[model samples]
Target: MKYDPIDSQLFIKNRKNFAKYMQPSSLAIFNSNDIYPTGADSTLPFAQHRDIFYLSGVDQEESVLVIFPDCPKEKHREVLFLKETNEHIAVWEGEKLTKEKAFETSGIKTVYWLKDMEKVLFELMTQCDTVYLNTNEHYRASVETETREARFAKKLKDKYPAHSVAKSNPILQRLRSVKDPIELEIMQQACDITEKAFRRILQFTKPGVWEYNLEAEFMHEFLNNRSKGFAYTPIIASGNNANVLHYIENNQQCKAGDLILIDAGAEYANYSSDMSRTIPVSGKFTDRQKEVYNAVNRVKNEATKMLIPGAYWEQYHVEVGKLMTSELLGLGLLDKADVQNENPDWPAYKKYFMHGTSHHIGLDTHDYGLLHEPMQANQVFTVEPGIYIPDEGFGIRLEDDVVIQESGEPFNLMRNIPIETEEIEEIMN
Candidate 1:
């Protein structure tokens, strides 16, 4: 892990909150994600399951956590199972977490080698009448591959058929959605790293530069700042590619008059910061480009203010759609008749701004949050609004992460990052 060790208190407090919500005499288990395969021997980098990391801060593969607050033995109440490390194993695959180190990282005293999982689980199952299991229940999740946690769930259910099963997603969705102070700090670190990368690209992005070069600049700054890299796939779309939404080809050379839409963020300590900014490849926006850029910026600013505690996701889009519609009208991209004749199901504004205005941003780039529920304080979200016009040869988007406050306005985490056209121009000059 390139990131520094996090304060385990966050994990400790998270476990306490989750434990409080568990059913009486119930045990909850979380397993680490599998190191997926690319081909023979080669594998994709392992990403720790967010739920387990949220509770224990264990960022490694082949790990398990069990939380049973109702257990008779105090030590056995919270336990960690890690892959065993020895001299031979250390030489080949590097040192896995030792029992002592796992205790320090997770704040859970009872730790065991993976080989002893069955014996310890058998003991824990005897004391608990119910078991809490995790699943990919995020609103946007479309997990086709069976995860390690999914396999374990199947195994546990078949082995202990009599135990009552419960879904852990409900408790986690609410708990993880609201950012604690400690978590906010980690996310701030990620945002700071992303700022460095963005500032670097401001001067480096010029005519004839490949989009991949811009991606490289971000990665360099991220690694220098102790980040593993992008929180998600980095999008460095140039010109008409920007209108395609989710364009990650990044192979085209930026033209002098073209605009580049960069949707990227750095991952620090497994917490994420998502940001999107569209800038001119020539270090200056044309008259028409600047017009659309500021329009998108205005929409992004107005959309963020609506992230109050009671705001509903579905209704929030309705409000944002109105704002975007006005902007599109002002740009002459949509006529008044377009609005009047638009289908209620697909608003006229969506022709330019199709996606949602904001989404919860945290441990995952698109973090887990129920869209049906009202918003709450301390919940972090990204307010991104874009206007894509392929005919105009430019698309503009502006985004920032902010925290919903209890009384007043939401606090912008990217306030220090250069955003204003004047500020960005000055930095590039």
Candidate 2:
């Protein structure tokens, strides 16, 4: 991990909150994610499961965390199972977490090697009547590969068929949705790194630069700042490519007078910062491009204000759609007659601004949150609104990560990153 060690108090508080919601006589378990294999003797980078990282701050594979507040033995109530390390293993794969180090990292005193998991779990299973299991239930999740958590959950259920099973996803969804103060600080750092990368790109962008060249520039800035590169795949969409919402083929040459929409961010200590900014390849936006850019910026600003407490996720998007509708009408993309004849399900504004305006952002780019529930304070979200015009051969999008506060407007994390047309132009020139 390139990032500094986090205060374990954050994990301690998170575990306490998780325990408060567990059923009496129930034990909850969280497992680390698998180091997925890419080919023979090679693997993709290890990414810790967010649940275990959230609860224990154990950012390693082949690890397990058990929380049993009702246990008769206090030491056994919270235990960590980590892969055993030895002199030979240390030489080959580096030092795995020692029992002592695990305690320091997780704040849990009782730690065991992975080999002893079954022996320890058997005793706990007999004492607890119910077991809480973690599962992926994020609204946008479409997982097909069976995760380590799912495999362990199947093993637990097979062995302990009589124990009552409960889902931990709902509890986690609500808990992880609201950010703690420490979490906010880390997320802010991620956004700060993203801002640094964005500023670097503003000066580097110009006509004849390859899209991939810009991508390399972002990665260089991110790694130099101690980040593990982009939180998600970067979209360095130039010209008509911006019309494709998920464009990532950053291979074309940026022509003069064309616009490039960069949807990229940096990941710090497993936290994600999402940002999208459109800029002119020629270092100055044309009259028509500036108009659309300003309109998108205006809509982004207005949508951010609606992210306060008690706001409904579905209704919030509807309100944002109205704002976009008005902007599109003013842009001449939609007429008054188009609004009147538009379908209720697919509004007239869909022609230009098709995607949702905001979504919860955190550890995962699309973080966990129940859309049906009302928004709450401390919840971080991305306010992104874009206008795609294939006929005009350019698109515009502006986005910022913001935190919803108790009162007043939400706080913008990207406030320092340049957004104003004059500001961007000034910096570029």
Candidate 3:
């Protein structure tokens, strides 16, 4: 991990909060993510499962965490099972967490090696009447690959058929959605790193620069700032490519008059910060480009204000659609007839701005939040509104991560990053 060690109190608090929601005599288990393979002798970098990290701050593979608040044995209330670390293992692959180190990292005293997991789990199962299994139930999830958590869940159910099964996802969704002070601080660091990268690109971008060149610049800045890199697959779309919505093929050279829409962010200590900014390739937006950019910015600003406590997620988007429709009408992309005759299912604004205006942003880019519930204070979200006009040969998107406040507007985490057209142009030039 490139980032510094986090204060264990944050994880301790998270565990305590989660325990409050669990059924009595229930033990919840969280497993680390599997290290996926790319090919023979090569594997992708290990990404810890966010839920486990949220509760235990164990950021390594082949780890397990069990929380049993009602355990008869006091030491077993919160437990961590880690891969055993030996001198031989340390020499081959860098030091894994020792028992003492695990305790320091997670604030849990009872630590066991993986070799003793079966015996310990058997003992725990005998004492607990219900078992909580961690599963992915994010609103946008479309997972096809069976994860480590899923595989463990299947085996646990098969072996302990009599135990009452419960889901940890619902509890996690609500808990993870609201930001603790420590989490907000970490997320701020992530956004600050992203701002550094975005500022660097402002000066570096120019006509004839390849889209991949800008991507590399962002990665360089992120690494220097102790970030692992992009929170998600970056979109460095130039010109018409921006209209594709998820364009990541950053292979084309930026033309003199075209606009580049960069939807990227940095991840620090497993926390994600999402940002999207559209700038001119030549350091100056044309009259038409400025018009579209400001419109999108206006929509983003208005949409962010709606993220106050008690705001409904679905209704917020509908209101944002109204804002976008007004902007599109002013931009001549939509007319009174276009809106009046438009299908209620697909608003006229869908022609230029199709995607949702906001989503929860945290440990995961599209973080966990139950949309049906009302927004709450300290819940972080991204307000991103874009206008794609392939006919005009450019697209414009402006986004920022914000924290919903107890009163008034949401606090913008990326406030330091330049978003205004004049500010971006001044920095670029």
Candidate 4:
């Protein structure tokens, strides 16, 4: 891992929290993500499953974690199964985690090789009446690929037909939503790295530069700061391209007086930080551009303040819609008639600002947080508001990652990143 070693206490605490939600005499299992194949003799990079990594801090493939708080045997309460490493395998694939290292990485003292998983699991199934299986239940998830966790879950159910099965997603959704102090610290590091990349692009962007050049600049800064590139597929949209919500072609040349909307972030230790900023290509925004940019910035600031505890996700977006409506009205994008005759399903402001104002940002860009539940302190979110004017040939978006506090306003993780029109202009010049 390029990132520094995280204290195992975070994983220990996470496991304790997760175990507390499990039924008595029940065991929960989590599996690492598959190292997917690209084709024959080639494979995509290995990315650890966020759930297992959250609880074990084991950033490797072919690993499994089992949590059984009420186990009769103390050591079996929390066990780790890792792929055993041999001298020949070490020489060919570099060193894998040793038993001692696994213990250090995760707080679990009992470690066994993957070869013994079936035998040990059989013993464990006999002791527990219920089993918890991890699943992808995030609101934005559209997974079609069969993950390692999914495969394990199928086999486990087939082998233990008598055991009552439960979903781990509900417990994890709530637990992972609220950030621990250690997790907040790591997320802050990710935001700081993203800030560096944004600042770099502020100086590197110029008229006639291709959109991909800025993308490369951001990647260079992320690598230098020990981050694993972007948290999500980056959007380096320039001019009318910015109107496309998920534009990532980054092939167009940035003309002078045009705006580039960059929605990118850095990932540190598998924690994600999401940020979005729209800047001018020529180091200065036109008068009309400044007007739209400031309006979006104002909406973002107000929307962030609404992320306090007790705010419901659906209601929060409704409120943000009102804020955006006012801003769009002021910007002359929506007139009185447009507001009054708008469809209730899609308001007049949707003509300009279409997407949701905020989403939970953490391990994944759209992290796990039950939308039906009220917001809580320490939950990090991204407040991104934008106005896309295709007729004007540009778009404006301003976003920041914020932590909902116990009291007062939410804390901005991207506070160091330049957002104000004057500051961005000054930096670019």
For all the candidates, what are their Cα RMSDs to the real structure? 0.9, 0.7, 0.7, 0.8
Q: For model 4, how does the per-residue alpha-carbon lDDT over 1-429 read when each residue is reduced to its tens digit?
A: 999999999999999999889999999999999999999999988999999999999999999999999999999999999999999989998889999999899988999999999999899999999999998988788999988888999998898899999999999999999999999999999999999999999999999999999999999999999998988889999999999999988899999988999999999999999989999999998999999989888888888888999999999999999999998889888899999999999999998888988888889889999989999999999999999999999988888999999999999999999999999999999
Query: In candidate 2, which residue pairs get closer than 3 Å at backbone N, Cα or C atoms, i.e. clash?
Result: none
Ten-residue stretch with the least lDDT total in model 3 = 132-141
Give the runs in model 3 whose Cα sits over 4 Å from its true position.
none
lDDT (Cα, 0-100) at 94 in candidate 4: 86
Clashing pairs in model 3?
A: none
Candidate lDDT scores, in order, read 0.92, 0.94, 0.95, 0.93
User: Residue 191 lDDT in model 4?
Assistant: 95
Error of 4 at 308 (Å): 0.7
On residues 1-429, what C-alpha lDDT tens digit does candidate 3 reach at each position? Answer: 799999999999999999999999999999999999999989999999999999999999999999999999999999999999999999998999999988888899999999999999999999999999998888789999899999999999999999999999999999999999999999999999999999999999999999999999999999999999999999999999999999988999999999999999999999999999999999999999999999999999989888999999999999999999999999899899999999999988998988998999999999999999999999999999999999988989999999999999989999999999999999999
lDDT of 1 by residue, 106-188 (tens): 89999999999999999899899999999888888888899999999999999999999999999999999999999999999
Q: Which ranges of candidate 4 are over 4 A from the true structure?
A: none
Candidate 1: stretches off by over 4 Å: none
Query: How many residue pairs clash in all the candidates, one count each?
Result: 0, 0, 0, 0
lDDT preference between candidates 1 and 3, better one: 3
Clashing pairs in 1: none
